[model samples]
Each structure stands twice: as structure tokens, then as C-alpha cells.
Target chain A: MADGLDIDHIARLARLRLTPEERALYEGQLTQVLGHFRQLAEADLSKTSAPFRITVSDVSLRQDIPGETLGSEAVLRNAPASRDGQISVPRVVDDEA
Target chain B: MSESLHTLSATELSRRLATGSVTSRALVESLLARAKTHTVLGAFNSLDADDVLRQADAADRRRAEGKSLGPLDGIPVGIKDNIAVREQPLTCSSKMLAGFISPYDSTVAEKLKAAGAILYGRLNMDEFAMGSSTETSATGPARNPWDKDRTPGGSSGGSAASVASGLVPLALGSDTGGSIRQPASHCGLVGLKPTYGMVSRYGLVAFASSLDQIGPFARNVDDCELLFQALAAPDARDMTCFTAAERKPVHLPQNRKPRLGVPRALLEGVDAGVRAAFDAALEFYRAAGCELIDVALPTAGLAVPTYYVVATAEASSNLGRYDGVRYGHRAQGALNPVDMMERSRSEGFGAEVKRRILLGTFVLSAGYADAYYGKALLARTRIRDEYLKALQQVDALVTPTVPSTAFRLGEKAADPLKMYLEDLFTIPANLAGLPALSFPVGMANNLPVGIHLVGAPQAESVLFALARQFEGSHALANRIAP
Candidate 1:
């Protein structure tokens, strides 16, 4: 079991930008947390199979018919930036130079 | 007369409403006044008195027309902020969604409206329902009404405190791992986390999808069950919710005394006061003709560790949608989209949320998945099997809801692992997808002690029956925090 975590790498992967202070704080705390979680390695699961999802028997599925949904105006009401009834975001690609 | 209306049980309130002894408007006004008086308890994140009174007046009109909706008509109920209610700010007590208002009502909210229940306050919770105490909330920690210095065990601390303090007769809370029950235990109330698929989760902001179940907090089991019946209907919007046909098969046998299971090994390190109360509770059950059987749950110790892995993993995925564009807070001065997303998340989420996201990302990362996440999943299966096996030998398993009563605020705040251990007994039920209920048995150290009961899958009726039997004999059933 790894005793320490790469907080910077993990934060990057999680899409969170941590300050040096947060990184230091989380590095210590998460290491201790993972140290406790590492006990899972001691569990004897020789006979058990890890299913990705827990089976819930008799779950009823609705028909494939399209139904009412929130209108664009209502949906975009909470958006940080919007234009012409659409959520506006930072540019994803650079313009061709 | 209005002052005491907040203290009456939902059943009693319903009778008063039926007989015109009290108007829905009167009850809402009473609760609003009480909630304002106890603002120090920090039970509410948002309470729109005008809207609530309007809803109440509508219910009163319906009653006046002799068109009452049912037992819940004209009754006020607090809602945990995570569950969406149309036009209400659903913050989840976090800065991430600070000003966001829900455009649509969650299934639970819709059901409460359909039942003619007046949706009251936006109850506070741990940010994203992440912590055992409400300390993680961006607004502030909700103080236990029992003792303001202490926590009212959480993620649903506000829900428990609101009801326990008589600000509201009923509140809805979601439990991923003991959120509702632990708070209920600390505040001396009845809380239930129904079978995993029993309640629809259409609009409950997901914490951990598999383990998350919305339940009720009330002063007694009857009130809890009444609210549960209102919210437990299956919804096609939530595919994991079980159909009515699927839920019909499990019924508690009325002819025989329930055989209560005691996991002696798991009870080893509990506090002496809590142990004494639990022992007394067991004796009461035994004297009441319940067959007490010593059952083993050997794999239960790993439940906490297993839960962190699974819950964090799920939370990390579910919370990814708050990317600063569609909804929630967005940070300024970012050169690119990726930078903006990262900066927004860093500025938006609280410390505990960031920690979990990092831990989840780490465990699910390449090379580490097999060692941590994969192993935890295997352990989860073992834990589930152990619970199922134990249930086969007993009608229900009984344990202390928490190791001890509510702790002083900031006692476990600095220690994350210590806080996680608060859910030790409660996590197994969530992991196994079984129904569990927590009800106050007695007091320890001038604080309430709760006893927990775990039942078989889809056997909420069995758990409720057992809780009612105990509550009928226990004096602490209708207690309100001073």
C-alpha cells in the first residue's frame, strides 16, 4: 500500500487547483485517511466477486417515449454566463494562427 | 396555542387540521416564529416565510372546501437543501451552488406537494452531504439543540435539529452512510434509511448513488412511516427505484415475536454510557418477548474503509457536472476552459470536498485502482454477504446508532479519520442496501442515546414495526431538545 499521495497530480486529475497550503494540508490528511483505508487489503475476499453495480431486482424501466423536459430558458437561468438561450463557456480551442 | 403547535407530532397536527382546531397558516406561522427564535441553532439555510405561508394558506383553502389531500395535508415539513424544490435555492449548504435555484421539483418534493404538505425551510447539511457533522457546511455548522456546544450528528444535522427543536414536526433527509440516522440519534428523534431502491432519487443531488436513500426524520416511528409512505413511490425517472410489485412481497409476520440479532464483536469499543443504554434496550426487548440471538458480522469492521472508497468515487463522478458553465460558481481570469474549470472548482468546493475529490481521483487513477478501489469493492461484497447471512438468522439486527452521543463541535473536526469512524455501525446497512432505523432509546450523560435496527432488503415494514414496538414502551419517543 502507498503511504503517501501525490496531491498535485490527484488534484489535477480531479480538476481542482490547490494552493501550496491546500496541497500540504491534503497531502497529510489524505495520507492518514488512505492509511486507514489500506486495511481493505487485509480483507479476505477469495470467494467474493466484485460486481460493478449492486443488483436491484425488479427495477421497472419506463417506455422510450420522449417526455417533457426543462426549457432552455429555465435550464440556462442558473448558468454563470449565457447568450441567446445557451450556456456560454471559455473557448475550448485556439484560433488558427 | 400557536406556540405549542410546533411541538405536536405530525399525527396530532393532522387531527387538529382535520377538526379545524388549527389552520395550516397558523402552524406555518408558529414554526416560522420558532425557527427565527432559535436561529443560533443554524438549522435552516433558507426559509422563505412568504412562500411557506402562501402554501399553507392554499392547504387551508383546500381543507375549507372539504378537499383535504390526506393525513399530511396542511402540515409543514422541512426539506434538506440538497433535494430540489422548484424556485427554491438548493445550496446543499455549500458555496458551490450558493445562489442556484432549482427549476424543477425533486420526486420527494413533488410527492410532499401532492400530499398537500407545506414545504417549509431549506435545511442545512454538510457540504455535498460529505461529513458526519454539519461543520463542513459553508454556511456554518448546525448546533445541536440538546447542547449548542456540541454537533447534532450530520450530514443531515439541520434536518434532525429542526425537528428535534420543534421548529418543524417533520423533515426529509438523505442518507448515503448514516447521514439521517446518526443525526436523528444525536438529536433524539426517529430516522429511517429505507431499502436502497424503495425511495426515488430523481432530484436528490447524488452523493453516492448506490448507497444514497432519502428518508424521514420525525419525533416518532408512526410519523416517520407516514412520511416514508408519501415519498417511497417508484418513479421511472429514477431507474434504481423499485416498482410497487417488487415492494409488495416483503411483509412482517404478525404472529411471531421478532428475533433480534446482536453483533457482540462490533459492540466492543462503544462508550460505557451508550453500552449501558443499549444493554438496557436489549433487556427491554428480551423482557418484551423478543428472542435475542448473538449473531456475528465478522466482515463489518471494513465497512467504513470500504464506504470511503465507494462513496468518494461516486461523488467525484456526480459532482463533475458543476463545471462553471451550466450552473454553480465560476472563477474569473482563466486563460482556457480547462483552467477555468479547475479554478472554479478550487474556488467553489470546500476543504472536505476537495480532499474527497483528490482521494477519489487517486484511488480510481491508473495502477492504484486494483490495490485500493478494486479491493474495497470486493470487501463491500463480503460485508453485504455477512449482513444478508445475519438477517437470515434473525428478524432484525440491533446495535447502537452511534458509538456515543453527540460530541462537542470541533472535537473531531481536525481529524477526518476520527469523523469517518462515527458511521461505523451505520455504514454496513448502506453498503448492503438494507433498511435501517434509528430511534432514541434513552438518555446518556444528559444527551440522547439511539438504538439502531437493520432489517432485510425491502423490509422497511419489519423495521418500522420493531421500532414502533420499542417506541410504544420507551418514554423518549416524543422528546424534543431543550
Candidate 2:
């Protein structure tokens, strides 16, 4: 089985902040799930290839053309906070880290 | 006719509308009343009787003017909360999108509306379509109509429940790793997961994009087919949707009995009751002149693990957009943009959703990508090739959709691994991009047991044909919930 996942690093990479209880709960649960994935490593699939990469034509790519787009009002309607017709976000790049 | 309008199929409803035996308004009001009365089932996330009536009125006016929108005109259909329907709240049964109104309708919603189907309430689902049972919904669990104590298999729980309980004759659901079929199995209804890209996914909320396909749930195969016909079309909006000419099914010879493949390995550990029902279904199929062939899928055992790796990897990428700037729940009192995003996601998502996102991030992370994600993609190829090889000998594969009937609410929630195992039987089709349908075959302990027919890529019609045959011969087809 794979070693225990770094729960703290994973949460940070995922941009999630977990409580102490949650961290304990997830660390155990994730280990169990990853152990299941360990079974896949046992398979002898050295000759196998993904269907998408093998058959590249399966994906239907649309032609590049200008089409109708949602108006700015409709786009901004669900924003949590808006200022001057733009979505508002927390200030970044503070003087000190 | 109006008394039982809630129970009528979309086809029958359309006929009645054409004959003027029932008005769309009356049917909508009747279904709305039924929905309100059955709120104990937790089947609906958001509903507005006034809005439904208005849409129904428009349908009635269109019929009065003799310009009906084909057969689905005025049919009341439930939208699983994850699919966008314009002004409706696309909640996906999570707090993150609690009040987020969709700016545009999903491709399915748009197609259904153009066909004159009334886009009704937003049905409840597993948060972000991550769980097999709807218990993961932050909104609350959708109860099985068969027994309120048990869960309606999810994440299309509400879609299946609303149809099973006669609240709506039809509903649209997105299936990623058996989300649509398992619930249909548990609820004793018809759920179809179209071949990947057969139906557009433009406005449907992304769970696992490559595996997810929008499909339908109904009481019978015909309604399922009609809903699928209306929803399946080439959409310039969704690059993945195939053109009609590109998806033609391979034809079988005339006057030949169709061969059905039975994957013996996957059936080994099913529940006793489910096994018994499956055996009976096989007997029924044999008696009906189908040639049952034993097929081998050696890598079928790897489906669950491979699904988690691939699905989570895609989910982590898709869900990255919910960083609190554009829409959805935002956190308060944060020092920086990064801190705000962290808290907003942590607080907005449910535990199951967070678990998946974390797992997904881990697999895609630099050090682990080759070990987990890359290996999973290779395993997926092996399974898909195995299935393709097996399908060459048979028209389709038949297996139990879920190992058992609906388990009690919270039965498998505690063990995330146990819950992940629930998708073992259904995930292979998703990995391979094939069409599969689940329909009731029998009842065990008063709960419905479902059997699925998996067909070749873009072979939805073949699956539907086999389902229609089984549905016709069985007593479970039109059985109503108590």
C-alpha cells in the first residue's frame, strides 16, 4: 500500500482549511481510499494505452467562431460582492507576508 | 385522466394534451400539489408552484394555437440541482452553490424547453455528485419512496424518487459513475446514461467531466427513450457532443437471436437477495430466447479504484473555479485573497466533497501523479479493452446495477471506502464511455432490485431495446410505490 498522504499539504494545495477534527478524520479516511488504489499498481498494464490518446479523433472539437455571449449584468448577477460592475475579491500583495 | 396525470408517462401526457383531455396547467398543478404533500421525502431542493403554472399555461396556449412542440409538450420534468436552468438555483445540494442562480440554461434544459417540456423544480442530489447515496447533500437526504428509512440511491436520488413516487413523470439527471443508474435501480425506475458525448454537457455542473453524461429517469422504457431523444442532439455549444452521423450504432443481423454477455466475476459478492433476483432475470432473458454468454473482464475488479483516481483528478480541476470571486458562498473576514478562497471552500463544501477534492489534489500532485493518476488511466484502458473484446461476442452485458437494494440512511456514509465500493458494478461503463441503462427486474424484501444492460460505445438504442424487452416481460416494470 502507498504511504500515508500528507493531509496538510494536500489541503493547502486544494485551498481548503480543515479543523483539527476534520484533519484527523480525513487523514484516516484518505489512507483507506488510497490503499484501495494500491491494488491498481499490481496490474500488468505495460502494453495498455488510454483510449483518448490512442484515438484522438474521438473528441469533437468545435470550430472557432464568435457567438453570442452572456451580458456583463447576467455574468455579475451571482457575484458575492460587486463593485463598479466587477466581482470584488479580498486585497492581495500586502506589504508583509 | 386528470386524477392520475401525475402517474402518466410523458408520451401519455402528450397524447392527452393533444386530445384536449387534460390541460398542462391542470397536470402541473396536480404534480405541484403532490410534490408539496410529499415534502417528507426531501425530493425537491427548490420549487415554485407559480412559475410552474405559468410555464404550463404557455404550453396550453401553444396547444390551443395548434403549434405543439412535438411529443414532450407541457410534460413536467424535474431537474437535478446540479444542472443549470437559467434563473433557477443550481444548488447541487451543497452550501457552496446554495443561492447561485444560473446565468444560462444547461444544454439539456434548453433542449427540453424547446421541446415544450416544463422545467420544474430543482431536485436534490449528492453534493457535487460524489456520493452513492444522497445523504451527502448539505440540503438533507432524499428519502426512498419505498421506505423513508432507507436512502434513495444517489446522487440522482431526487430525480429517481420524484418519478417513483409519482411527483413527476420524468426528470433529468447527470450520471458520473452510476449516479443515475444506481438510484434508478434502488427506486425501481428507468435510468439511462447515454454514451459519453451523446448528450451535451454545456450547462450541467461538472463533477467528473469525462465520465459525466446527462440522462433521464422515468417509470418505463418508452418515457426514458422519449426524454433521451429530446435531449440528444449535436450542440455547437458542447464540443464533446457528437454529431448524429458520427454516433450510428453497429447493426446486428436480422433473424438472429441477440447474445447477452454475463460477466461472472463481478457478480460474485452481490447480496443474496440481489443475486436471486439477478438469476431470475437471467432465466427470464433465456426463456425469452436471448443467448446468454459467459464473458470475462479480468480487470473489472480495478474499476472502483481507477474511477476514484480519474474522477477525483478531473473533479479537482473542475471545482477549482469556486474561489469565491464570481458566484457561490463566500467567506467573511479574511486577510488576503488566498485566505478568503481557503475558508470559503472549506466552509462551503460538505465533508465528502472536501475529501474527494483532497484526494484528487494528492493524486495530481507532482510526486504522486505517476503512481496514482497515470496508473489509473492505464487500468482504465485495460478495462475498456476487456469490455470491448467481450462485447464483440455479445450484443450487451447484463449485471446487477447495485449489489443490494437501498440501504438505510447513513449506512455506508461513515466508511468512505465502503461507499466508493458501491459504484464498482457501474463505474466500468463510465470509464469506457459506453451507454448503459438500469431497470427494475424484481422486488426483494419489498425493495426494488435493478439489472443494468451495458452496450457498446454509442449503442444507446441497443441498451434501450434490451431494457424494453426485459421491462415488458417482467412484473416489476410498472409497479407503483406504496
User: Which candidate leads the pack in lDDT?
Assistant: 1
Candidate 2 reaches a DockQ of 0.68
**How well is each residue in B1-482 modelled by candidate 1, as lDDT tens digits?**
88788779999999999999999999998888888799999999999999999999999999999999999999889999999999999998888999999999999999999999999889999999999999999999999999999999899999999999999999999999999999999999999999998999999999889899999999999999999999988788898898877776366677887899999999988999999999999999999999999999888988999999999988888888878878999999788888889889989999999888888888888878888888888888888988999998888999999999999999999999999999999999999999999999999999999999999988888888888888888688767887
Pairs in steric clash, model 2: none
Instruction: Encode model 2's per-residue lDDT on B343-377: one tens digit a residue.
Output: 99999999999999999999999889888888888
Q: Residue B228 in model 1: shift from native, Å?
A: 0.5
Docking class of 1: medium
Candidate 2 structure lDDT: 0.89
Q: Each model's number of backbone clashes? A: 0, 0
lDDT, candidate 2, A1-97, per-residue tens = 4584889999999999999999999999999888888888677778886533323244466688998899989989989999999888888766686
lDDT of 1 at A72: 92
- Measured against the native two-chain assembly using Cα atoms, what DockQ does each of the candidate structures obtain, in the order listed? 0.76, 0.68
User: Relative to the unseen true structure, what is the C-alpha lDDT of residue B175 in candidate 2, on a scale of 0 to 100?
Assistant: 94
Docking class of 2: medium
TM-score of chain A of 2: 0.80
Query: Could you tell me the lDDT of residue B23 within candidate 2?
Result: 94
Candidates' C-alpha lDDT: 0.91, 0.89
